[model samples]
Target chain A: MENIIELKNLRKVYRIGEEKVIALDDVSLSIKKGEFCCLLGTSGSGKSTMLNLMAGLEKPTKGTIRIKGQAIEKMSEKKLAKFRQEHLGFVFQSYNLLPMLTALENVSMPLTFKGLSKSVRDKKARDMLKAVGLETHIKHKPSQMSGGQQQRVGIARAFVAMPEIVFADEPTGNLDSRTTKEVMGLITEMARENNQTLVIVTHDLEIAGYADRIVHILDGNIEKIDIINARRVSNEEADNIISGADAVPAGV
Target chain B: MNKRDIIRLAFKNFMRRKTRSILTILGVLIGTSAIVVMLSLGIGMNESFRRQLSSMGSLNVIDVNPWYFIEDGRGGGYSGQNVLDDKAVAKIAAIEGVEAVTPFLQTGLRLVSGKYVMYANIMGVDPNALEAFGYKTAKGRMLTEDDTTALLFGSNTPYDFYNPRARNNYGGGYVYFGGYMGDGVERPEPDVDVLNDKLVLTFDFSYGERRPGGTGGSEGGNKKPKLYKVKGVGILEESQDERAYSIFMNIEYLKKIMKENERAQGSMGPRPGGSQQEGYSQVKVKVTDMNNVQKVQDQIKEMGYGAYSLTDVLKSMQETSATMQAVLGGIGAISLFVAAIGITNTMVMSIYERTREIGVMKVLGCMLGDIRNLFLIEAAIIGFFGGLLGLGFSYGASALLNRFAGGLFGGGYYYGPSQDSIVSLIPAWLALLALGFATLVGIISGFMPARRAMKLSALEAIKTE
Candidate 1:
């Protein structure tokens, strides 16, 4: 497997008026193509910061970050925007689908940036919503949908543009346990079906159980890299686990 | 993103707050109508001037005369120096704004029928340039170049003829002629029909004779007159002008008759006197514009000839009208300025509300230029619709003026040959300019808000609500 994302000595410092706090301290990591990776840490442990850095959402204070051989740390704002539009997709924790837009319109947003005809983008969006099993909720706005359903729309939007990497920043943070399990299953299943790279940031052990590799962080530094070698859970098995059949069966 | 997407997104954004958009558009509407109506008043006044001048003569026609003296204080009474001859006529015709020039070779002649004879003022003109001079005949056709021996009778020309024996009491021009055929009944009409009359014309050298007290004698005991048998080709309608009392004829024919009379008199005519009646009495230069009339007249004056137009009175009237127009326009401009402020307020509020949307668009790969253009197009749409509706309001306002105030200016269509009724006038070009002006105001008012939208930080904007 080839590494599609590389981080070398990455550092980020935030200044709150005067006091400076280190968010990501010399973070170094690599994720292979088509691999599902998880950054697991508690609050203030910089898991979200690391995800943001890899996703080119913020500037790094020092060192280089590359994705698919393209420089992320040094890219200009305009070029980074193009990079994100062409190669990256994001699902925020709050299910950041525009409240004014319906599920299908939200899903087709990235494709709109791609300049596809309205009918073509709508067709693609319809297919993605159907894939997430939200075909009936396609015309419902984010405000009108349930947490699980809105997250499904977010996942659909993330993969609709066919990006190489999808960043999930605590994507199930607002959903219930049952919805969380279902949302995670849909995200990982979509990634595997498309052979796309997925990077999720979360503090949930159940959510981390779905990843192929879990990298743990503490106090802005990588604590350990845990490679999970276990049978992958299908959407049916994830449902069963939520129904009290068994847990994800973590291997230490 | 592509243009369609950007426009679609912008349109959707504009639709998000419908009331605000409608209010802003209404503000622009008020502004546009203000400017249009104010400017229309100015145009109406100008149209009135044109109509008033049209009744007198062409506003484009400037009359040139020889400047007889410098001033009373110095070098005065140097009269009859510059002859307004063929050379000066050519010179005036060569002027830049001069569309055409015709010399007035006026001769006082007597038209004699069998027993009735009348004295008339005969103005010589180039027959080919009659239509250009706006001369319209009421009876027969106007004199053309081929009508070398033709004459056009004025409405008053036939009425001026009287029996020489009966001419004594008809001095005031309203007395009965032909022995009062009957006092309680109608008087005998002129023996010759003006348009079909074959009248003998006798040139008297005292015609256009500038001599002091030179105009006294006509058909008297010590005179020998040269006669030419002439035919009347046309009759002019009555107008509030001197042309109503004058006869017009081909210039070359008048010149020939003048020269023959001079020869017949053998150095006893006005040509041999200090009066110098050999050249044209006056030249009328047709100008291209009423505004350029003064300039062209000044140019002719610089050539040492005196020039005048009704614009001398009209210029004063227009100067006063201009001040009124400016005041009117200023009032309208103040309203438009208030409307522009309203537009700016709306756009600024829009930016503040749409910060998150702008951030989302920026994150979605929309360019900064695209964002700026989107806001501009939104503002322009407001102006576009406002201008369209404002022009509609202006038309209604103008029609109301024409309906209620038509007699204050003109009787709707009583003025000659012009489309304007004069209460409120909006020329096509003024309407176009008002639309463009409203659009520009919208764009300018949107400038600051659009820049602020462009400067918003995308990361912070997204984090904000």
Candidate 2:
């Protein structure tokens, strides 16, 4: 598969007063087209930082980031915003939908940035909401919707623009186990149907089971890269596969 | 986003905080109306002054007096040869902007008709120049060059004839008290209709009165001055002009009479070999336009003559009004300034409240310039609507002032008794300018807040609550 995203020697550091905190160090990774990849990590494991860096939300201290064969690391802020609108989508952990906007409006926002007319963007957003099973909640504001429902709207927004890559950062962090499975299934299913790349960052093993590959990150470093042959593995199978990969030497 | 969409978003955002936006617009309304009404009062004052002055005389007429001291420009001063003569009249007529010039030959005379006699200050003028001098008659017509003996009566001159013998009688010599009298007393016309009666003029003031030492006849030593039979050609329309009290005549006829009087008195007209310089003591010059009166008067003065025009008075009056306008407009601007501050405050508060929304829009690929334009358009909308409404209010205020504010000045000289006086005026151009100015104020007030919105970082703004 062709690689849609490539990162080499990526480093991120935070300066807190007199100390330098390294959030990410010497991270070399590539995400393939139509690949469902997961960065499984606990708190303070630099998974969120890696996601932000890869999305061009934050500049890295040292690295080169190539998305769809275009170097985006040194791009201007304006150019980066256009690049994000054209090729990238993000589903935040908090499901940051505007409280004043309805589900349809929230979903249509990304298409608005693409300068689509109101009628066209509204129709596209309506179709995306229906696909996410929130067609009946199109006019419902985020404050009026449940946490799981709002997450669905967020997922609808991320895919409505048909971006080349969609990044999900703990998209179901506030949802129950049942809702999490539904949102995760919906996101993976949509990405697979469109052959779009998906990157999920999460601390949950059950969430990692949906990915074709899982990269376990610890202490600002990639501890193991586990390739599962069968997609949508059971939680128990995902744990064994990741534990077996961790047993090998660091370079293997 | 397209411009139309941006404007729509701006309007929506402005309406989001309806109460605040309305209050801000109200402030602008008050400010705009205040300035407009205040400036209108100043304009009204000047208009009234112009009306009053024009009633007194032609504002464009310049009176040129002969200067005795003529500066030869070669150290010779006071030559006394720069009199307002025929040569000077021709020169003045040739000057740019001078429409017409006529020399005045004035003398006191008495008119006798029937038993009534009227003493009149007769002004002799070029027969052809009377119409250009703006003389309008209530009857007959102005003097023409073809008439050898002609007389034009002043509006009030016809009413001034009185019978000296009726002075001691109960119902006696009458003066028209402004064409009004007590109840049932009809306004009396002139006892002697000069236009129809056989009239004779003489330089003698006691022409029709009995002499003290002789019988009432043309006797020796008390002989009546040479009586010239003249016809009253016209009666002037009653006006505020001083000409309403002066009689007009052909200058050549008047000069011939003066010579006849001199001959009848058996006096030599001039010393032999002493040059008899013929000139007029005063000359009247009419300007083509009122605005050009000052320039024409200056040119006349440079020709070694003293010139005065009513435009000087108009200019001084205009200066006073301009000062008044500035002070009034300043007071109005202060309120507008306050309104501007209110707009800025409202925009800043709106920015603070919408910080998260701005960040989201920015992250969604809204241009920085678009965000700035949104706020500016919002502010401008407030100004535009306010200005439009303010102009409407100004018209209402103006109408009210004209209707009920009459005699507010206590009928002072500046506020004359003219029936159509305007107390407050707002010309169309002034209304338009006020609207544009108010809009500009709104744009200026919105500038700083818009810049702050544009400079806000997307990351930080999203992090804000």
Candidate 3:
């Protein structure tokens, strides 16, 4: 498979009142098209920093990042916004849906920035919500929904725009074991069904079990690259795991 | 994002904090109404001054006098250097903005009808220029150039007649009996009907009464002073103008009578003893518009003639009112400036609250310009609605002031052609200008806060609670 995202000698340093702290140092990685990839590490191990640098949310100190052969670092803010609108989707760990909007409105937000008609955006959002098992909570606000349900809506928003690359950062970090298993199943199933590149950053080993490959990080350095599962998870297998018909398994 | 979506999002954001937005808009509403009402009072004062002046005389008419008083060290004497003759009349007419120029000739004569007699001050004007001078008749037609012996009576001219032959004649004094009397009773009409009575004018002031040292018939055997049979052509409409108390006649006919009076008396006329009659003492110049009166008057003065118009009085009055308007407008503007500060504070507070929402939007690919536009539109909406409601309130306030404060000004009664007195006036252009100004203030107030929102770092903003 062709690489969809490439990082060469990536280095990120944070300065807090004159103290220089390295968040990511000399890290190189590649994410293949249609592959489910995970960056796994403990706290302060630079997994979240790697995700931020890759998403173009932060500028690297010294590095080059190419996503689908586009050098986003060289792009202006306006062009980068357009590029993100067309090609990328994000799922925040805290479920950063606007508190004022309902589930349907939240899901349709990304499409609104794309300038789609309200009818088209609403229709797509409705379909994505149904796919995420959130059809019953379409009109529920985040304040009214459970943490797990809000995270499900967040997942729906990430995929509703049909972006080529979806990045999830600890998407189920606030949920319980049972809800975490369901959210992880739903995210992997959606990525596989759409044949999209999925990148997730998490410290939980069980969440990393859903990815085809994992890159382990320690102290701002890549420790190893492990091939977890060569074949993509099938729809039936994902459904069984989410319904608890099959036992939760680890990536061996 | 498209314009519609941006507006929708902006509207939604504004409505999110309903109480805060309403309070901010209320501040703007009070500011706008304050400015409009204050300025309107100044306009109303100027309008009332114009009405009062117009009742006294035409604001567009300039009185051009040939004689100007020159103050020498000894005393002051009238200078007759600039002659207000036919050539000067033509020169003044040729100057820009002078609509009509006519020499005013005036002399006192005795009017007789049967046993009733009155000493009348008859003013002769160009027959063709009567209508242009804004003379309107209530009874008969104005004197035309063809009517040689025509006369136009003043509204009070008939009321001036008294029975000089009566035993208690009060020494031939005028009996006032024309207007509304005290205690709201209508006074009796005059005994003489000037428009229909057979009337004669003579140079004899003692036509029917006893003279101071001789009998009343004629002085020193003068042949009854040549009675000129003049027709009563018109009676002027009753007004507060002093011109309503004077009589009018054709200039040529009056000049012929003056020459006749001189010939009959075997002496010189009212002019200084010159072989030829001296030029008119004063000429009236009518300007096309009241605004042009000052310009025409200045040109006339430059020609060494003393020019005076009601616009002179009006200009002084307007200067005082303009100062009043400035002070009033400044007071109003201070309130609006405070309201602008209120808007800025509200927008700044809202930026703080919506930092996370803005970050999420930017991360979702919302344009930086769109974010700034959203904030600006929110502020402008507040200003527009406030201005609209404030204008409505200003009209209400104006009507209330005019209704209740009528007596202090003109008592809601105007004598000038078609206008009524008002104490507060708001024209259409002022309303529109206030709205535009309020909106501009809103935009200016929102600029800094919008820039702050635009430059907020998306990563840190989303990380904030």
Candidate 4:
């Protein structure tokens, strides 16, 4: 498998009242094509920052991020926006769909930026919604749908453009356990089917267990990397291990 | 990206806030309506004045009078001098804008019938030269080059006969031409037909032969006398006030009568006193255009003579109209300024409210130009519709004004050949110019807000809670 995303000594710093707080210090990672990798960390452990840097939404303070072998840290804002539109997709934890558009419209948004025809974009968006079991809820707005359904729509949107990489910031942060499993399952299944790399940031061990590999973060540094046989375990057995691991505090 | 999408998005955005859009458009409507109405009224007034002046004479006529030296610091006598000669008349005619010149010579004469003698002023005009100066014939034919020996009667003269006791009988017997042809008592209807009537004039000129008392002699002894036949009747439609009391005769006929009288008296040689009778009292020159009347008048004045033109009246009318238009335009501009402010406010508010939407579009790969164009198109749409509605309102208002003015003044106040009942008189070019100007105003008013919208940071906008 080819690496779709590569981070080299990535560092992010925030100035808080004249003090440089290192959000991510000397972080390095690689995400292979079609690989589901989760960045598991407690709050403020720089997980979201890492996701944002890989998604080309923010520039790294020091070091470089390459998406499909193209360095994004040196890219201009205009080029970055084009790069994001063409090669990167994002699902925010809050399910940040435009309130003005329906689930179908939200799914078609990235394709719109791709300059596709309306008919083609709409048809692709409809097909993605059907793949996510949301054909009946196509016209429902984000405010009208549940958190899990909205995340499902977000997942459909992220993959509708068939981008090389999909970066999700805590995909199941606002869902109940049942809905979390359902949404995470949908994201994993769709990303795998489309041969798209999925990079997820989450504090929930259950959500991290859904990824083939998980990288643990502590205080802006990678603490450990854990590989799970996600394809070998039944979904029920995977849920038991995920819920059993939740008994421990996230960082321990 | 394409025009269709841009227009569709702009339309959708505008339709989302209907009340605000309508109010903004209304502001523009008031501005455009004011401009249209003011300009229409100005045009109407100009046409009215032009029509009135045209009716007065050849808008091209210029009257020339003799210039005299002051005796006691006041212009007294003519000083027995002929300032404008036949050569000067010819020279004036040769001027670029001069169409014709008629040397007006007037002399007091007694017109006598049997017992009905009326004292009249005789004005001499060249029979061939009157037509170019806006003279029209209402009854008989106009004077011709060959008809130099006849007189032309004015239309306003009364010529009727009636019996004394039949005045109340309506239809009665009357005597015609000294013959008693009557049924009971007849009064002839007032003669509106006085074309080609004869008028006889008798005048006296003094040279060296004066009476023992040193006064000019009467027509009886050693005095000049003349008579001319009636040939043409001219209707002075424009100058009835000036021509009503006078009669027109061929200039050559008057010259021939003078010559014959001088020859019959055997005074062909130079007179003992050396006075010449070849000078005109006044000369009225007609120019080729009303616009050139003032220039020609000035040229004439440069020859050390006094001249006047209708331009003085025209100037005063133009000044009054300019003042009126300035006042009207000021009011209109003030309203337009208020409307512009309203547009600015609406745009600013829209920018503030749509910050997140702007961010979304930016992220969706909409260029900065596209965003600005969208706002400009929205503003232009408001201006376009406003201008259209304003034009309609101006049309209606001008029509009502024309009708009211016509009713009060006993004739249409607006002057034009058509005299259209609805005088919303904006010329086509002016309407186009108004619409264009309004659109420009809309664009300019939208500039600041569009810039602000363009400057919005996508990160801040999208991250805003």
Q: Best candidate per TM-score, number?
A: 3
Backbone collision count in every prediction? 0, 0, 0, 5
- Give per-residue CA lDDT, model 1, range A63-110, as digits (tens): 889899988878887787788888888887877777667899999988
lDDT of 2 by residue, B1-465 (tens): 667767777787778888998999999999999999999999988888787788778899999887645567998866344667889999999998888889888777888887778777788889898788888899988889977678998887887777766754213233453443224575567777878889988777776676787654356755457778889989998776668778889888877777777667666454221111556778999999998998898888789888887789989989998999999999999998998998999999999988877776776666677789989998888888888888899899988998888567322464335567767889989999999998999889999999999878776665412
- Docking quality category of candidate 2 according to DockQ thresholds: acceptable
Flag clash pairs in model 1: none
Q: What lDDT score belongs to each candidate, Candidate 1 first?
A: 0.78, 0.81, 0.83, 0.69
- The share of true interface contacts that also appear in candidate 3 amounts to 0.53
B1-55 in candidate 3: lDDT tens per residue? 7789888877888889999989888888889999999999999988888878887
Best to worst by DockQ, what's the order? 3, 1, 2, 4
Scored against the native two-chain complex, candidate 2 gets a DockQ of 0.30
What TM-score, over all chains together, does every model reach? 0.84, 0.81, 0.88, 0.69
Report how closely model 1 matches the true complex, as a DockQ value: 0.39
lDDT of 4 at A209: 74
Question: What fraction of the true Cα-Cα contacts (under 8 Å, chains A to B) does candidate 1 also have?
Answer: 0.32
Q: Cα lDDT for residue A171, model 3? A: 91
Deviation (Å) of A65 in candidate 2: 2.8
Q: Evaluate residue A175 in candidate 1 and report its C-alpha lDDT on the 0 to 100 scale.
A: 88
**Residue ranges of candidate 4 with Cα displaced over 4 Å:** A1-10, A16-21, A27-252, B31-192, B196-224, B233-307, B394-431
Q: Model 1, B1-465: lDDT tens per residue?
A: 678877776677667788988888888888889888887878887778767777777787898887544455766645445777788889899999888788877778777665566787888889877777778888888998877778888766777766544436255344532333223675455556866656878765343223353433343466567667888888887565778778999988877777777777776746421223546667888887767888898889778788888888778877877898899889888887888888788889989987876776666665677778788777766777778888889989988986777666543333343444577899999889989888888888888888888877766666523
RMSD of each: 7.0, 6.0, 5.6, 9.5
For each candidate, the DockQ is: 0.39, 0.30, 0.50, 0.19
Which is the winner by TM-score between candidate 1 and candidate 3? 3
Q: Write one digit per residue (lDDT tens) for candidate 2, span A3-109.
A: 78898899999999999999998898887788888999998999987887887767899988889888878887778778888888878777888765789988998
